[model samples]
Target: MATATLISTISTNLRQPTATFQPKTPLLFRRRQVVAFESKPWESQEKVLRENAFVCAASRRNSNSSSSITVTDVSVSELDDKLRKVLQFVLWAAEGVYIIWLFLLPYAPGDPVWAISSDTINSLIGLSLNFFFLLPLANSVGIHLLDAPVLHPMSEGLFNFVIGWTFMFAPLLFTDRKRDRYKGSLDVLWGFQMFLTNTFLIPYMAIRLNKPDTKYTPRKDSQLGSVMVNGASVVGVIGGAACLISILWGLFGRSDSDFGSVADRWEFVVSYLGSERLAYAFIWDICLYIVFQPWLIGENLENVEKGKVNIVKYLRFVPVFGLVAYLLCLDVDEEV
Candidate 1:
């Protein structure tokens, strides 16, 4: 009885030990999971920062290259921007002056931009065509716009070929800047939008052949991406050729009426002085427009006395509006 009492007393005094602890396995696993989750993003952030630093350094190295003489030093992007701004400003200002003068020709101050008469817009339609075709040829006849010097008796005729090319080339410029207000553009929707990557060929040539046979491709992609790019490139070339051909056809396919001689004929003088017939004005406009091409080209040509005028790009269109007006006149002639 004494022994049994003593054992019972010991058991009661010591409560059973509960399962309370682990070997720290779960805690270790949780810590490892958190580190792994954070590592990938951290590595990515580091890579981005390093890349940005490299670019920043390269740009700084190139920023002042034009001041010195070196092949790689022209600061190409900056030069292009400067040219663009200058061009845009010149174009807008000239257009604005001409439009205003045309709107209020009779009362406007001293001969505002070619004495633009306040003719109705309706009269101006189709007039642009004349500038596109005849002016170049008339220029061939020695009546250069602004009465510019006739390089030769046949200068105007010789100029016709260049003007034809410019007119036929109308399509690509339209596509490149579709928002631009030119006619015959909407009809070409979904007609295999050209890549004009061939135009980039000029830049590539500038970099490659200009250099020691170095190439112009930027970083290459994966094999699949490369294949896709090459395919798109080929398609671009074909589409550009098609567009060029179509535009060329329009300029070259002049009617007998187009190539007809107008000087000294009653039809010519009557067409010039008569009522606001769309056709006559259109023909005259084309003549004057092409007449003006050389003048505008001169404006773009660089001179030491004048600063560079890269912005002089497409200023040829300032006179083109006059040509379009002529085409509108033709529509009237057809109607009567």
Candidate 2:
């Protein structure tokens, strides 16, 4: 009976479906098995950490580059400001001294401002007549409109030469980018400058150096400015021709005037500067022009045509002819 019972149990076990059977296990062991089958989190976390480190390094580099650029810009601005201040101070000082020494001081090599000499007046009249001299040249050719005063050609030539060169500066001043920095009318200033020369120009130079303000609006150009800017080439030609003619006239002009040889004319010029206040003041104007010509030209080089900029830049240091060349080479189409 027991053997028959055993056989029945085995048959019962074999008859059940194989899918119905399951083995029991400890809970801890089952938890460990499930954990083992999952994907690794540490590798992914490491990749994410590396990516973040790279981003931070790149940001730091960019910040460093920006900081360096900012420092460079600040330094350049400071240097320019310092230079502007120095130039303004020097120009103002020059103006004060120029007024005192030329106009007020009795110690200078010419007559004082309070006194007037008939000989000086006569010389002034002669120089003025010699400037255009339509009647004088006509008189020289026997078609006299009036009597022409006879004078030393060297003195006349030197005076007109300086004046003619100064005439060209009118256009240059009108077209300057910094012209608006001046509060006064350019027309009056330039007009006076023709007679007084540096007395007006030096003040304008110093005034223009003032820092531009937000309240300032650019003024429309005056009729004089328009004429000068438009006729710059004509002005250049006239001024340049005048200068050339002045030199030639000094050396060989007025053949009938009994002026001595070139050596004698040169001697007269040397003595004339020492003896006449007007002539002595002209010497001061010439020196100032030499310094100012390059300064104004260098600043306005952008107004020159592209092809001629390099040439104008180098020639600017030259005195009278340099200004002539610039006016001739101006880009007239450019707005002043």
TM-scores, all candidates, are 0.24, 0.77
- Give the winner by lDDT: 2
**Candidate 1: where are CA atoms >4 Å away?**
1-76, 107-170, 177-263, 266-336
Which consecutive 10 residues in model 2 have the weakest lDDT in total? 31-40
> What does candidate 1 score on TM?
0.24
Query: What ranges in model 2 sit over 4 Å off?
Result: 1-72, 141-143
Q: For model 2, give the RMSD to the true fold.
A: 15.5
Across residues 1-336, which tens digit of lDDT does each residue of candidate 1 receive?
A: 999999997776444222122456575444434343443577776675564565566676767765443534457756766775665565455445444443345443222334534653322322332333444356557876733222211112222322333332222222221112222222232121111111221222122212222343333233433332234324334433433433443333333324333232335334333443222223333444354433434432332112223333333354433222222111111101
How do the residues 1-336 of candidate 2 rate in per-residue lDDT, one tens digit apiece? 999999998877655534233457654445434344434498865565564565556666678577877888899999999999999999999999999999888878878777768887788877777665555678877987677777778887888888898899999999898999998999999889988899999999998888887799899999889999889999999888888888898899887768889888889888988988998999899999999999999999999989999999999999988898789899989986
Position 164, candidate 2: lDDT: 91
